[model samples]
Target: MTRSTDRWGVTGTVTATASATRAAAPDSATVAVTALGEAASAARARKRARNRAATVRTAIEATVEVGIETVDHRVTNSAVTFEPETDAAFRAVEEFHVRCEPDAVATVVVEATDGGGGVDHVQFALTDTARADLQAEAMTAAVDRARRKADRLAAADGLAVGAARSITTQPARPGNEPVDDAWESDPSVHPAPISVTERVEVEYELTAAETDMTVANDSGKG
Candidate 1:
């Protein structure tokens, strides 16, 4: 409920948030490169690690043959020093976000890294086309919710709901984080449902009921 102006031009504004969920499988996974060696061989190890990372990235992009939608990678270097400050070894780490089928995730990562690194995280998300559809539905639901609330408030006050004067919506928020590892226990298992939420604010005009207008006319006559 929101503000109103005059008695005959009452307004009912409602803000509502509505959610829609879609069952999704793990379509993407994150993998970390574990390439470390003594400082003496840091230069050589870094090269090999980069090569391995490159190979993994290529494999990920070529997974579906038509090419996966997302394949991102970043490289980082860190040094671990012992009690003797001089005794330190550098490590080259590369992480990738690979899009692939849930069932083939392990196989792809293992084969790509030659059984060196392991899967770090798995995520579930709707494809671009599906996401757009879901967002539309969610937004509609939010607006409907606001409308219902406004109607109820108007009815309680002996007023009829009228045309919408204004409407506004916020961007939808889609959840795509790695929720669980149930896929590890069962390859065919689907990921948890992903929810998208949309918020809307609507302003509706409130008009006096016909009975109320008739009563006012009778009073004026008396």
Candidate 2:
């Protein structure tokens, strides 16, 4: 028998790849309200936008006690421009983000978009705790799937599987990084389920021949 060992134990090596997917309702929501205005003067345009934003903020504070905190929200984008050569009007823009519970999202969005409101967008997302928990569960499921696969393949070849020699994950895609989830909020809308997937590749070493490969063979039948 030929034997070789480089990274994942001896030459009797088997590799298993699998992906686990999990779906859950979002736990929280974030609403983005953008206030924009145009006026003859820069200061006047800015004031108009701020006034409109304040009205929306007051509406939010009434619905939810959290209110739009100034420190939490920031001016993500802003600019001023002249209307034309003859016209000296300036346009102003400001955006504020509001974080609130999933249940309260509908109420807040309605208030923001009501009566020509300044709501640019409303988004739904999973809470930090929910995200972390789901990640752990998905990872466990992927590993279990890989191990089971390895066992069945080894049994078919009249061999027994040993400890994993190495384990690694495929490089994530360019835009696969975790990004803040957002959506347009509607009263009758239900938050979409959050789906998380975990992919893993494991290499296991062949220990010895299986005397009775009944379990591995039977499990694969179903």
Q: Model 1: residues >4 Å from true position, as ranges?
A: 1-39, 54-89, 101-103, 170-188, 210-222
* Candidate 2 residue-wise lDDT, 52-139, digit = tens: 7788788778878444644222221123323332233565566778888778877777877772456666677788799888877877
> What does the lDDT read for residue 185 in candidate 1?
36
Expressed as tens digits, the lDDT of each residue in 1-222 for candidate 1 is 554666554455433333333334434443333432224456754666566666665655565432333233323233434453334344444555555555565556555456355455455455666556666777677777777887787777787767788777755454532143433433345566555566667777676767887888788784
Error of 2 at 217 (Å): 24
Candidate with best TM-score: 2
TM-score list, all predictions: 0.63, 0.75
C-alpha local distance difference test of each model: 0.54, 0.69
